[model samples]
Target: MPTVSMLDHLVLTVADLQATIRFYEDILGMRAVSFEPADGSTRWALSFGAQKINLHPADGPFDPKAALPAPGSADLCFLSDRDLDEWRQHLQAHEIRIEEGPVRRTGATGPILSLYLRDPDGNLIEVSNALHS
Candidate 1:
């Protein structure tokens, strides 16, 4: 069996590629690294530190509708040692609606403070800071 090491990218089909790109770029601070032409459509890839996120056009003929992540759904967590309050302020300042938990010390893995939000395509993302040893 072949082994999987890490996630290279997450591809999301979005209703508006440019709007989604702006959310990820302007709001999340991701950088657009590349664009590719695929058949009659285009794909844009954004970089967040070591991860790459690919956004595909939702209007493509065969494109599937974006699914609502289930309650307590799949989440992507970005970790940092920075102040959690600062991150909360940054998201709020951008008018990004935060869902929950800048709630501190909620997990057994460590003492962490996190904020949750959904991207334009309805994917859940959590930005957190670990405070314990």
Candidate 2:
């Protein structure tokens, strides 16, 4: 049997693509980039670390997409090199509200300290840093 390794990217269907880009860039420090598909249309994506998030308009004609794509429906977690305190301050400085945390939780590797917030689309977002043993 074969195993899947890691995520390369995911598509997010968005109500407002620019707003989604702004939230990810201003708050999370990700980069927004444009790509020209084989169809010759320019498409947008957000890139960070080893992953990318491709953005699709909520109103369709976009193909080979999620069966039921909708905004405000994703719950995403991102790893941080910065500590929770720094994330707390950064989010505060951006005037983004924390829904919960600095709460301890299980991470893929070990224990993690997480801070929860919502993006412009109301998708739940968790920013977390691993706690060493």
Candidate 3:
């Protein structure tokens, strides 16, 4: 059996692709890259670190999409190097409200401090950093 190495990408069904792109680009500091699929339609994806989220228009479904496709139904967590305070400041500067806060959570790596917020499409977003002694 082949084991999973890493998550290459994920798909996000968005109501407004441009708005979702802007939120990730301006707030999360991600870069949006556009590509043409086999259908010859232009699609965009937000790139950060080594991962990317493919943006699919809610009305336009690719070859294979989620059975229950709904916008704002995703809950994603991102690993960060910034501490809670710095993350708080950055969110505030962008005028984004925090749904929940610097709470204790165990991530894939280990213990982490997480802060939660909502994206433009109301998708839950968590930013966390490793907790060290």
Q: Estimate each model's TM-score.
A: 0.73, 0.94, 0.94
Clashes of each: 0, 0, 0
lDDT of 2 by residue, 25-128 (tens): 99999999999989898999999987999999897627988778899989998999998899899999999999999899898888988999999889999999
Candidate 1 backbone collisions, by pair:
none
User: Which stretch of 10 consecutive residues in model 2 shows the poorest summed lDDT?
Assistant: 59-68
- Considering TM-score, which of the candidate structures 1 and 2 is the better prediction for this target? 2
Name the TM-score of candidate 2: 0.94
- Candidate 3 local accuracy as lDDT? 0.91
**Models ranked on lDDT:** 2, 3, 1
lDDT of each: 0.71, 0.92, 0.91
CA RMSD of all predictions: 4.2, 1.1, 1.1
Model 1 lDDT per residue over 37-60, tens place: 554555578897888866656566
The residue-by-residue lDDT of candidate 3 on 51-71, one tens digit each, is 999998898867689999889
